[model samples]
Target: MGTAPATAFDTEALRRGIEGRDAAALLSLYTDDAEIRVVDRNTQPSHPKIVHGRDQVGEMLNDIYSRDMTHHLDRCVVQGDHVAFTESCEYKDGVRVLASSMVSLRGGKIARQILIQAWDE
Candidate 1:
């Protein structure tokens, strides 16, 4: 029997990227052609906000990490080429946001991701 190969995804790096608010570090985990679909109050399940390509994803990450907020990786699960995680954030004003994400990995990099999020209004 052959053993499975080790994945390149680094959960520790993910935690550091999110907690440290390092957009570039997070971006490094994604493939060049990665795609991300986000669903929230404004963008509902029927119509998700889609971001394609590393450049676009990078722009989004930069915008998010630039905000005056604190982020924490609540939970993370990895199974083969798939990963799921929950993240919580709090703004300076006390507003809170929570997000859950499922990601598909290709060659150890994120190829696609679906994220569902909610925030205090």
Candidate 2:
């Protein structure tokens, strides 16, 4: 067959995708069956709960943009097909929070994502 493209996820590319708020680019990073879990800082297990799915992930991002005007990635680490990062942002309501996210890539597309708040106060 032909040589395969790199299977690794590029942190910088993903950063640009997120920072640029490019939904198509962001979606392109994810696999068809990608899983995404998000736990809001103020949310608990008993509450509405974590979000899951590729489309859901996109929806969440859209919802976030509906509120927050901007979001910035502070740092990221890429290992094999996985990437983890920390992001800081202020919501449209002016609430600031730090979020830690872990992503798994397969065939150069994101296969899963686990995100949680990374703050004590």
Candidate 3:
């Protein structure tokens, strides 16, 4: 029998891919029907940018990959098929963003992710 896919979150690979801004690598970890909700200072708790499916997610990923910045997974906690993590990023021109995410996995791929972020003005 084929071994089941790993449900455990691979923090190292995830961190490396994000830090390097490899959108493809990031996308590879998501399911085809994955959804992502993004909330920032502009998009508050009530109103979030909801990205549905891999195609839309790909666009968002492309945007991230286009940015000239450094990414780091500051902290992470995982239980079962869920994970929560804080991300720190410093972009060019001295802009810094701190983000936190709660993610759910399906079939070892990210099925949903909710993110909240804040950037220095």
Best by lDDT: 1
**Poorest lDDT segment (10 consecutive residues) of candidate 3:** 3-12
Off by over 4 Å in 3: 1-6
* Residue-level lDDT tens digits of model 2 in 1-121: 9977667676677778668766666777777777777676567535634556677767776766455456788998887777888888775666677888888888877787877875434
**Better structure of 1 and 3 per lDDT:** 1
RMSD of each: 1.4, 3.5, 2.7
Best-to-worst TM-score order: 1, 3, 2
Q: Give the TM-score comparing model 1 with the true structure, all chains together.
A: 0.95
Better of 2 and 3 by TM-score: 3
Model 1 residue 24 CA deviation in Å: 0.1
* Pairs of residues at least 3 apart in sequence or in different chains that clash in candidate 3: none
TM-score of each: 0.95, 0.75, 0.91
The candidate, 1 or 2, that scores higher on TM-score is 1
Least accurate 10 contiguous residues by lDDT in model 1: 3-12
Q: Which runs of model 1 end up more than 4 angstroms from their true locations?
A: 1-6
Error of 2 at 23 (Å): 2.5
Clashes of each: 0, 1, 0
